[model samples]
Target: MANDTGREAVKTVPETAGEDQQVQERIRKQIASELNLPQAKVKTTVTLLDEGNTIPFIARYRKEMTGELDENELRSIEERLQYLRSLEDRKKEVLRLIDEQGKLTADLKASIEKAGKLQEVEDLYRPYRQKRKTRASVAKERGLEPLAGWILSQPRRGSVLEEAAKYVNAAKEVPTAEDAVQGAMDILAESIADDPKVRAWVRRHTQDHGIVVTAAKNKEQESVYEMYYEYSEPVKRLPPHRTLAINRGEREDVLKVNLDVPADKIHEFIARQYIRGDSAAKETLQAVIADAYKRLIAPAVEREVRGLLTEQAEEHAIRIFAENLRNLLLQPPVKGKVALGVDPAYRTGCKLAVVDETGKLLEIAVTYPTPPNNKVAEAKAKFRQLIDKYRVELIVIGNGTASRETEQFVADLLKELGRPELQYIIVSEAGASVYSASKLAQGEFPDLDVAERSAISIARRMQDPLAELVKIDPKSIGVGQYQHDVTQKRLEESLGAVVESAVNHVGVDLNTASPSLLGYVAGVNGTIAKNIVAYREENGKFTDRKQLLKVPRLGAKAYEQCVGFLRISGGKNPLDGTPIHPESYGVVDSLFQELRLEREQLGTAQLKARLQEQQPEELAPQLGVGVPTLRDILDSLQRPGRDPREELPPPIFRTDVLKLEDLAPGMELHGTVRNVIDFGAFVDIGIKNDGLVHISQLSDRYVKHPMDVVSVGDTVTVWVLGVDEKKGRVSLTMKKP
Candidate 1:
């Protein structure tokens, strides 16, 4: 394996070409090109991280070395490397299995060596591979394979039954030739099943054209699985929701599900592969394979194809969920105002809390604004007194238990007071209960009840989503689809990336950011996060981002990635409060120099206008940076001291609450979609049970997936299709009635 210079040689290592080794090699070459190394020098043995390359580091610092490989491409390279290595290990294991069976023929060995993909290699290894006791073994035990073949030959118009009967002697323990041929047919069935080419072909055909057919095992069986009692659809075309539902139905034993490929098509395909044209033996061979299809191969292949489809759907769901969660979490915060929080309930009344501009609790109370349970007039009075007493400018309502009724009650009070300036939001209270029971919640609110603590947290969430939301686990936020099913580590990694991206996108205010939010910033982990909080306690508020450099272990690289996303409001320099990374300060300065403008002289509104007028070609050359980067810097300089997440969108405020019975099919109604997985979108539609819009029912055009059209927080227009009050399930569709 040594090369001309004594290094490892670049070996082609012939593989069974399933997807294409060239695609993989192209990716490797791309990686090598990015690293500024020859393809030969970058061996497969090298680890990306051990070679001093981080994802961000390789993406940002080694741009010239990576041929400007972006984050997405780098991640793809990392994934493909793992898959290729796994394929190699699998190949070795397969070869070992065949060799140990002592059936490794020269032809078989040649086929395996020449194979360019895993599928092909596995195919060639199939016949010789060890397996459990089968019908083929029993036929061999009876010593009747040749007899079966002779009957198949039908010599001189002989009767097959008579010929088979002669072979079935008392010594063999077969009662008759019919029985002997049955055993022979079993052997042929096993042979057909073991054929690698047939297996590979069947797999491809099933994936490409198979349909999932479901039927009620017993039509009279009464259970919660009525909708899917008898349902069937093409595998590729089945929506994510129905797939999950059908799977659940099968698990619960109410339905029988099978992968349905046209039997005729498979028979024809197999006939082409195994049977010769117009021969006497052809009929016998066809009969054996037909028996195999019914008794052996069909079930096995069906299971394999079904499993593959499920895996593909699950992966698609995980990807969509991650993206939707990112957007929802990164939404702009409505900051710098006192907020009144309300945790709405009917039996206990609405629990309320008032927090100061910085989200420190100032008061708590229980109030009822409208009801047959409590006097509407009295409840309204109590609520008004609290709002006036606390001077609350905004209200935060938890979108939970009686939220719409409470919003209406509060809206009525606001209208009576003539305060149009006051606004309220219905925030998702996903992990509020979990947080309420946690040690952190207890430590923060030792004197307040759990409900009151929840109310206070809701208020703070509006003030700073990044800080407040980080206290709860990302998975608990309810924005993900099949969040529980994905590989736990991958889920956590993807969700963590989303949180970090969101936090960084809307830069944290260093002076006010909590340890949880700080920990997510680039280069700041839990220990450093705690240290920053401690340092701030000892040294007062941070006036500028430069003060971060003095914090222990806060290095230049970390500072560079994080500073732009960490803002300082009311600072001397306006740029400190914007997403203009400190490393690009020189570029901003040069832009100002060309315009004869001083740093302090720039105002956000005018500066943005001016930058737009000054072409990228005119400004980028002067700054000595790429036009893309220069344009971004100019845009940031214009809005020097701005909070990226300005105001949270107004939460759904309804005048009245309606039950599921109140909704009619074809009624156009507004509702929030709580979760979106691979198959379909789940819309709350203000009902007790959320209704599913199967992926097929999602749009007018062909939708490859539900995620392409909708996301978790999206407020959608849905037409109520049907309602099952007993099951507490509503059926809604995005399509117009």
Candidate 2:
């Protein structure tokens, strides 16, 4: 490898080759077993990841090396690899800590080495961990450890009281035989609690059989969590959404939560383990076992169970959020259409923005079409003038305050204009306000108010959801299930990964992409993204992928990671617009030469048919490329500059709006799914409230989860199941009524 200054840098393999090889093998085996993939594939993927290859890059460009593993599989392998490495590091630290204390037994060391999770390793090290003074430590200091050990042995010949009498020493705070017995019991209790196997058994038992019970702190107070006020469910069967809701309710002091474990069953299990003989010490030992459970083990185990539940819940929530964000971002963009965006308001006025086909702002206005002012005639006239002036083909109304009224107004206005081509869509305004108040939005529209900027954002989002939505924080997009309840750092990481995967999957236009969009490319960070944009401003639009090398802070590795995901049309090379990496250009050139086809015919149907006729295995060796790489190159050539999202169903645009009062039982209507949750999906049916389609109502057969049948941006036809005008709720069903 050569450095940036063009000097050859010496690369030396590490001297710890044997250890490195062993670690690599272990990681490969573990990942292969966990992901149910072949060992060779896991090995190659791990090697690439260890070599600092990005997930998207490895998945897209190194297909043969990884046996054609996709991004999701690679990401899973990457995440598990990091976790296992951390686990190994913790294991080493634990062994060293135990050795320093002269307590590293062979069995203990073996157990630590075999531990799969950090929690298990920590459990093994609990006895060796340094501690603050507790009843057990204090009792040990009083020299009652020997008595405790004798009690643990369950001596048949010795009387428990007589044994306890020997430890009574006033100088060490053991004044009476009873006091000495209590101290010995305390020591025994702590020992039982500290035993790794004992703790593990108890934790497993509680988690498998415990019931999570909740009660309302103030039942009369009306809140969204009323359904959970008297909730009780088995810990093992608790759903992630319920867990999050219970946690939030508890946090708000609106509910009292408890883990109810069977004490008698736990006592029986402990007694069976320790109380072996019918000696006087048996009763003492039994009493101590109960103390161990009630005083120490139960509390610790309860906390562990709760933590496990929360962790599982958070993982599920994050997964749902990532899935929703992916679907939402990948929604088909309404391209090549002039759009008019409306940010609806009541007392103020509806803010409007008109953008050309390329999302360039052409006009901005505020009209009093709703509420107090109610200048319907004047507002319609102004909107008509803007529509005629910009030749607006579509209208995007933000689904916020007064949204339904504004939609009705627009529907009426479109009818008055007598233009059948003009249609309107109620786009989700989630995070639009946040984007408007952001520094990026200020830079883009310094003269506009927050509402006006929001209107423009709405317009552009319809034009290209991925490009416009990337500007706002993903969590603010409102496509998640209890997103705020999860760990923010974890949620951010998962959502960021989702965004990056989606952005890379649908390659970005190098010339037109915003810094926010480019920042999500495989290896491009915010600074490098900004540098690229600045470079474009200072120089000119990137004519070739190689121009990325000249951008500040964008080194060879970063370019290697991001180049394939950034496309340029009419650039130096015809393959620049496709997903063909620069490193594979040689093979592509060979392919083109062998086929006797010009670069300009890359995306033609004839070229696709010709390429389809050639077998990859036969042509790969001649082109000096792997079969997988050759196949990918052929596919890219067949569909140059293809947007993967263009295949999804387009957003439903409405020519007329329906009011809540107009909905009747068994009335069939088309709706756009707004959000999918565990139990149901919320669908926008052109009303004030999005109707709910319960999991049971999603299909004729049983539906395990709403996401199984619907996603965030899916368009589905449904029939009204019921309606409550007083509470503003609409119940809809997808199954046959």
Candidate 3:
């Protein structure tokens, strides 16, 4: 091998930590087993992460350190590491608290220590925890704990009344034998409820045998939850989307959701655990078991199971949202000569803005092309003036209110001009309003109103979706189903990672990136990003990556983490424009020398030919670099400052508009995927509303999810399935006509 290639990722880890070495080792081994990664790699990745290495940086620049773990794998490791560490911390806290109360036992400590989930640890700690004025605590105060224990022992030879009589004391508020026995039974029942083993068994039984039942709160009050007016489904088979739907309905008070589990099975299991053969206390224990199930155990387990279900649903929803957002943000940027953006509205006239080649706002104008005003001629005249003046090659219309009307008007106007080279594409304006209303937008275009600013955003989205979309909150992007319904914190976290990954994947142009885009780059916070922009503004464009070290609050660590992702075109060192890290410049220099090539030959046909002749595997050893790094270096050198997103299919530009009425069964039409959900993908086929291609109609073969067949921003050839003009819905099919 010519370099330390991809195949030679280091498989050994050196110990270095101030935390518990044993616990750290345990976490490393556990994560390794769980993710099926080599333990050495997991340990090394964890150490790098602990040293504050960002996932993107570690993934891209430290392939040898991580044994070639990608961003996804590294993220998984970080998540699991945090969870396991939290679990460890809680285990110590629980043990300390139990020992302070003088109730800790060897077996109990072992159980809690061995618990895998936070829930399990909490369960094991439940019995020793202090209670708030419960019947059991009251019984213990009345000196009936001994009686409860006696009953639990199931002494067949002893008389129940005699034992109860001994516990009776008027001074302690137990005046009768029956009252004494009842208080004792309360103690016994509470003990049964608090037992972790008993709780685990009951939880498992409920999950296996339970049914989720939902019923209407008021049948006469119509809602989208009408289908759930009287519905029941087995708990084990409930899908994530339905779980979220049911939870939302319940929260809105439109439906009452409950779990129905087999009580007889639970009671029998408890009876077998607590009762001895032919015990005199059998009947009394049976009553206690039933009471425990109904009043204490059942409700708690139901809530726990519901919470688990919601958590799973939330994770699933966040995963889907992340994928959809990733695709939407990674859409291939369309480089038009000069582009026009139109924010369409009915009562308000359509707001339009035109941008120059580099996304500079050239002009802003408005025309009432749709409804109420119906000023088509005026709109056309204004657009013609802007188009001819700017030499606009592409028109981007926002798919919002009155969008179809605007599109139709533009189609007719383009035909009247007979400019065959000009075309139009509809861009999703989901978060344009949010962005325009934000302080960031105000800062960017303080002179314009919200509508005009939104129009400009629409145009820039087609030019560079990632840069523009980063300004808005990911929740407002409207790419996922039930985004608003899922856990906001988790969704935001996942979407943030997606944006970060996309931004880092494409690499940011150091001189031109806005603070919003730069902020998403690994190791760059909002302040640091703002400082970078301000530095560029004050010092002029960055001439090399080394200038980043001079930015305020940007230390050596941050520079190391983020500099590789920051590309400087026409920099002093040509390698600065590539994704190749500064640390590996020596290796790259060695490679260039060995190939008899010069930096001037980068991205030339000569360089490509030379790089094609040598194998990274054969050259990695001699170059003293990892094969993965070498391959990436070769690719980056071949196309320095390249945007990976540009390699993907460009937006399908439309020269004509199609109405819902124009679509018929089996009419083959090309479209772009607007959004993806559990049920299907919504495709924009140049219409008022996006058409749905349900999962069943997505392919000739089985598709577990619509994403498996198509993604947001995917250009697909679809056929019309049917139309419901009354509902203004167009059903589409991805299957061949």
- lDDT, candidate 3, 29-53, per-residue tens: 9999999999999988988877777
Which candidate, 1 or 2, would have the higher TM-score against the true structure? 2
Task: Report the Cα lDDT for residue 453, model 1.
Answer: 88
Query: Candidate 2, which segments miss by more than 4 Å at Cα?
Result: 1-20
Better model by TM-score: candidate 1 vs candidate 3: 3
Clashes of each: 14, 0, 17
Runs of candidate 3 exceeding 4 Å displacement: 1-17
If scored against the real structure, what TM-score would every candidate get? 0.75, 0.96, 0.97
Model 3 Cα displacement at 586 (Å)?
A: 1.2
* Displacement of the residue 178 alpha carbon in candidate 2, Å: 1.0
Q: Per-residue alpha-carbon lDDT of model 1 for 1-737, expressed as tens digits? A: 00111001112132334745665565467556665556643433223332423344344434445555565565555554555555656766777788888877787766775565666776777777667888778788888888767745545555556667777777767888678878888887888887887888888888778889888988998877787777778887887656666777787788898887887888888888777666555677789878877777788888877776766666666677678777667555666788988988887888888999888888888876535466578877777787788787888888888877787676677778888777666677878777777777887788878898889888887777667888777778777765665556777766676676567656678888877787776556666677778889999888878998888766665565556667787786777777676777777788888877777666656666777788887767767876666766666777665555554343354434457778788888887767776668888665555788888889988998777898666778898888888888888888886
Which candidate ranks first by TM-score, i.e. highest?
Answer: 3
Off by over 4 Å in 1: 1-24, 29-85, 92-188, 217-224, 277-284, 368-382, 439-449, 480-494, 522-564, 568-577, 582-614, 618-623, 641-644, 647-737
